[model samples]
Target chain A: MNGRCVITVGDLGEFGIVARIAGRLPQGRTVLLGPGDDAALVDAPDGRVVVTTDLLLENRHFRLDWSSAYDIGRKAAAQNLADVVAMGAVPTGVVVGLGLPATTAAGWLDDLADGFRDECDLVGASVVGGDTTRCDLVVIGVTALGDLGGRAPVTRSGARPGDVVAVAGRLGHAAAGLALLQAGRAGGAGPGDPAPAELETLVDAHRRPRPPYPCGVQAAELGATAMLDVSDGLLQDLGHIAEAGGVGVALDLSAFTVPEELETAARLLGADPLDWVLTGGEDHALAATFPGGVRLPPAWTEIGRVTEGEGVEAGDRTSEHRGWDHFRT
Target chain B: MNGRCVITVGDLGEFGIVARIAGRLPQGRTVLLGPGDDAALVDAPDGRVVVTTDLLLENRHFRLDWSSAYDIGRKAAAQNLADVVAMGAVPTGVVVGLGLPATTAAGWLDDLADGFRDECDLVGASVVGGDTTRCDLVVIGVTALGDLGGRAPVTRSGARPGDVVAVAGRLGHAAAGLALLQAGRAGGAGPGDPAPAELETLVDAHRRPRPPYPCGVQAAELGATAMLDVSDGLLQDLGHIAEAGGVGVALDLSAFTVPEELETAARLLGADPLDWVLTGGEDHALAATFPGGVRLPPAWTEIGRVTEGEGVEAGDRTSEHRGWDHFRT
Candidate 1:
């Protein structure tokens, strides 16, 4: 008598969920057909298409108790989209493979679809196709496709020594959110509910990421030499750029335009914002290297410079920040 | 020994397993680049591509205790490939998103990769790209892409009255295999333990499905009016074709060549092989409808006829089998 009533998907079925999710998809040139048939046809005019995939499982990637199904959907879609954006391609469409229990609430699936569509719509992409199967827990697998538009793909290996290192979108907030969730769960902060601190925002960031899509394409248009998304920690991902580029990277701490909210939370959490800036993960921020003196877009901020060095740096030292490690803690 | 020295993925990590898996992928046409990059691109000649996705989780789809990782990989690829083929298109490539616990063995991943390549090679297709992430258990999401090569995709909705229904692969073996496994676990006569029994073949069929690949293009070439692959049982998938094509179907069970091995196993397991033939799932057999005496390939068997009726039938009556229901059980 004290809880919300749940509506099982058995009550709604597969096609019913598709109908709900398909309603929010953006009308786009790349999507020839939305999601009614056995398969979908998408336009890949580049003669070549960029593609990446990711999977997020319940409790493993996100906890349903902490985040709504919608948030999980958005996070799933956003991360996969970010991978495409990292290739400096415009995400055209996404195919979602959702595994949910038979008893899962229909409303939850609808909300998750909403999140998927809302995120895809922001990137001018649509949910072109998908499959739904029953499982004991929620598992989402997303495949993202993008159009290069005849532009050369900005690979991670193309950066030169003199390229300028830049970043777009906020970083570290998602990690901060994870930390907040962990802290709240651990009760390391002097017992009781701590007056519902700003940790909720951090948790929200962890649950839903806002990838900077437009900035990624802009980097390509701005003549970036190479690019990649910061799905891992900035320092770790930057290390990839450096290793692939076969050059050293020196980032100036002063250059990172930390989001004001992150800075405030950093203070409240008794942590260094720079740690989040360098070591946090899941922001899905775009990081690219452009030729020196190139005019970059407004969303982008100059983070550092690429040089003859052999490793990544933060004000002359190897940054101690390492982002999410799939194996090691 | 507490337990045989079991190895886990934590020792190798996600990227390490990917490196091993991607290393095993064979290069093929349409794959501009394979794994190791942020994303991959495929050459889409017709300016449009057909896509379908599916999610198969461990235990629910396959038990690790019963299936080797290699078998799981093969089934995963085979199922997805069948979907593209069902659309009467040539499968070009596939991208897999695997969510597995950090403790999974490196050998398991290698076997899985081997399985993927074997099935992809069977169809002259390629494993172009994939994503690997950590999870508490194993979950596989596969997205299959196909090239129409300017041929209009043959869908399930194109069958008209008087269309001839045919099949391009064997059936019921997988279902029989499941029955055998269940019987064995339940301590029944159960398809005689790993012996030279019919259950061996049935088990093999379930572990790795051999879908009809060339039949898709051949059916399209031979002017198949409607087509679908049997993933969710024959009666069920055929029902989908009937519903989509807006026609009734009558399957002549006498025409079905029940493999003697499966029949023998079913008898030993005290199960009805006919039920497996009609209602069991995951054989991935291709079912197509042709108009008026259209010749089928040597691999195909004429099963039944499409009529102006309202539902599907096998022999004298409407199919009592519900076919397959994922959520229902």
Candidate 2:
């Protein structure tokens, strides 16, 4: 309680910190019962709930040295919500499992909670309940729940031979950002430090991916046969759709106009922008297959078509390798 | 996958391992959708869903040497599911977020998924969806969703003076097991290594806690005023009920009969069995308060009575400290 004292998470303890964080969360309509109980209750109007979960480790998912707690929180929520969106559902709530070192600063946790709140606010969701524990490193696990609003879920196994494959939102930006960080081109900026002007977008994309959340539901309503979020590279993710639907995909590489932001980063790194577009992952873009005659949504661009065969081919070049594999390293 | 290859998770890759695991799970009625997609859909027929999450880190929550992958999976699922049960709901599905080292064996993952599936099957639920990533250690985050059957949630803030405090399931068993492990009394035995018969019960209880799942809904139907899963020690957890309801609890020490199993362990360790009952945690038993004159269930034990005040007292002694604080160490 002293003015000069800087209390850590250890000082606040698990219950005290939970109370502090719970006080900061804004209650949304979906949550019938909130935190401070055995469990939280959420409305599931459609008689079904869509669920997904993701785990982010300190160095594996994001480096605390490079990203603020706020960035980590936002990115975690974005990716999880994107999964629900891919299932043609509206995100209703998130329950977080946070493992922090005992010596972690209380301020860092507060910032992290703020990040979750801000991201959830973007899509009208709530942080309902969670668990906290002590560990040697910072580990975050988020489980997102969503309501379907009575729509049939668009799964990966529904594509027909004549369907057109389309994408909504940015591509390869996160990978380019990663490339910049790997090349030390983003400049040595820590949290709250001013990132260099040239690489700001790239770095921010890598640190906090802004997923196009509503596109999944839109695609489903527009008669999407199959859909998935592109957390892995375009070709690799498309391969999942191909394999699941027992169809082949022929991509029109020329259809992809490299975003100007990625182009500048590509020029600086002397790397092929096409490679990032084809193989880069973590952009959280929504990819779906619609009936050939269906009118595409405004944000969607037709990238390819489903064919009779198997696997994916882009511009007569069969991909010899798929996009990012976590175990590749 | 070849017999001579002895492939690990690193060799299987994320998608490959996910495929292997997904194929093993048995589909249930509650799962409108299952894994191998961005998200899974589950039936929430009650119109509202009960949700809870827990994060478990290796070494901190469980040592790989001490627990089998199957045991770890079951324990993690049990703790999360117990939280839902405490809310007077039937667990319908679980989403897991797993962080594993690349070098983890494929066999270990299979066992873990099997563990999750088996536990879900026991409660007639299903494994809906999950995410996996590479990390230095194995970290598991589970979010369980439950249906309340249109019953009002039994929150922790509803107890009143003269209410009867009751518990369903074991106490002090896990702590006694932990004590045996800490004192090096339990011989160094891996999974299936024939634990000494004397300490087998304690050790097994520590590795996997069997919660009284159906008892929670029964308590709620019986008009429980306040309830929680006693993941923290009995006295410590009861203190939560007291604080939340702005009341006091008077525990009758004579009402507690030291289990014969814990008594033997206590004699060997030269420790008080009562201390383990009062302060040991992780048993995950359900503790609840009901109005006076309510008929207690067969599994329920009337342990104390609610008093007008704050904090918890047992006989003439008021608890000086609460049970397991994650930051205490």
Candidate 3:
């Protein structure tokens, strides 16, 4: 950290970071060319398209001390790709915009960019266009574009009563991870690491989210009635689907199971894994509703059912589930 | 300047922002109704597209004291759209990623949204999509999509000897405005209403760029040998066209004229107006070469002609000029 650098972006340099970051991209067979070109071109199928954008700022969304630049990049790309998939579309290309202070090291930017490329690789997408400039802090604005491949998009408003509400990804992990990190930072849990023996994986989950991309596309392919990315947490996100689809949902938490790693971590923080599962965010999981026994994708699991109500119910208690609010003080 | 915090986003938040922004958009006449949905659909002719992005950070690119959120929004959209026009394409739609402190007023965000809408309105393009998240400082990322509409892109690599070099708009005022603001902040500029007499106009140019959108599209339609936006400066940007086109240009600036506001500001600063004309940037004016009478648009005025030379020449003098390099020491 103390290697070199007079502050100011002039000191940190521009093209140098681009060069380092460009080296890490997979240039997946689909990528015609990565960076360095004035523009990047990706394969767009001969049909309609889907495009979405999301912006992430360091310190606001994540801390450098808590997450590597790579994790941040990957998480950013994952969230955007999840949106396209939620629309029943296959992501084809991405354009990233990065803003950083001149005091930032060349390596840090490179690592952050590498994170983006690796995440794009995970989602089977390619980097197309990007622009970088100096800023007071690190900011990433990613735009994900996709091709529909002639399939009609399944929007959030398509769910109907009697539809089975299902989720196809992990829950409670990121929240548990965040709780552990915060606990550790605050000297709440014993010591050593912030998370008790059980929860470090949860902390990892918070830093590096894993969205179920394939499950989303498959759900769409299999005629998902309504689909949404569980970025704001399960109960909260499901509430969105309920409202959008104009239906109510009751989640069977007793039927909901958590990975042992996440459960262990929740226990260390003296918290409920159920609460984490119900309210943790940044997981980028997909939650959808179907009419019947729709052929489930391997990565997805059944969780509950959509009914004729207004809110979400977990077992005995009904949860209002407000969703993640970024601007809350 | 203090106002009411009438809205709590958590109660109505991200979804609220989307609904409000999308509601004010011009979605009927020229734009289709895919705005608030998952993605937007723009009518792209020729089945080809040109795209570009740029990121602007507060403090690095602008000061809150000098610019309103609306101005920043317009500037961001203008810059990206200029790149599309540079490729001889018509802007179809725009997407934005905004990052700012959560505590900031929602109305300011609305003003920023207004700015984006106003700029896009100029080109009959709609604000198709965008994303917002919290950040320590304001960061704006804009991506502009355009349609070639059946014609090939007039690139920087098409100029040739004997091509008449012509410019479609004014050169450099934003840089001068920046200098005025810096001078005012340091108490270097004379005390008056705005420090510099033409400061208002210069500041206006910096805040909301007036790119010659129609002229560029028309120039391409008229078969421009090569085309580009004067983003860096007249001389520096033209140098790109020269180097890429494999032909040199002789800019007869002995017969040069500039906007009166720039002249007034230059005189007040005791600086040469020609310097601004030659190497100042951020005006986003169009520059192109022609093979014949160059079916010029009504707004275009021919300033110079391309010649078989080594570098650009202002009158008889060689322009070995370097424009303002933001990353330079």
Q: In order, what is each prediction's RMSD in angstroms?
A: 3.2, 2.9, 3.9
| Candidate 2 deviant stretches above 4 angstroms | A1-5, A187-198, B1-5, B187-196
Please write out the lDDT profile of model 2 over residues A1-329, one tens digit for every residue: 32547777888888988998998898899999998888999999999999999988888889997789999889999989999999889999999999998778889999999999999988999999888999888999999999999999999999989899999988888899988887766765533333357667878888888888889789989989999999988899999999999999989888999988788778777888888888888889999999999888689999999999999999645766578777664
TM-score of 1: 0.93
Q: Per-residue alpha-carbon lDDT of model 2 for B93-165, expressed as tens digits?
A: 9989888887888999999998888888878888888888888889999999999999999999999999999
| Candidate 1 collision pairs | A177-A202, A248-A309, B9-B103, B9-B104
Per-candidate TM-scores read 0.93, 0.96, 0.88
Estimate, for each residue in B219-316, the C-alpha lDDT of model 3 and write its tens digit: 88888988888877888777878887777888777556677877778777677777877887888888888886666666776777777775676763
What is the RMSD, in Å, between candidate 3 and the native fold over all Cα? 3.9
Each prediction's total of clashing residue pairs, residues at least 3 apart in sequence or on different chains, is 4, 0, 11
Per-residue lDDT value at B44 in model 1: 80
By TM-score: ranked, best first: 2, 1, 3
Q: Give DockQ for candidates 1 onward, in order.
A: 0.68, 0.82, 0.43
Which is the leading candidate under TM-score?
2
Per-candidate Cα lDDT values, in order, are 0.81, 0.88, 0.73
The top-ranked prediction according to DockQ is 2
**Candidate with more favorable, higher lDDT: 1 or 3:** 1
Give per-residue CA lDDT, model 1, range A140-191, as digits (tens). 8999989898888888888898899999887888987776666563223534
Off by over 4 Å in 3: A1-12, A15-43, A185-201, A320-323, B1-13, B28-46, B160-162, B183-200, B243-249, B290-293, B303-320
Strongest candidate by lDDT: 2
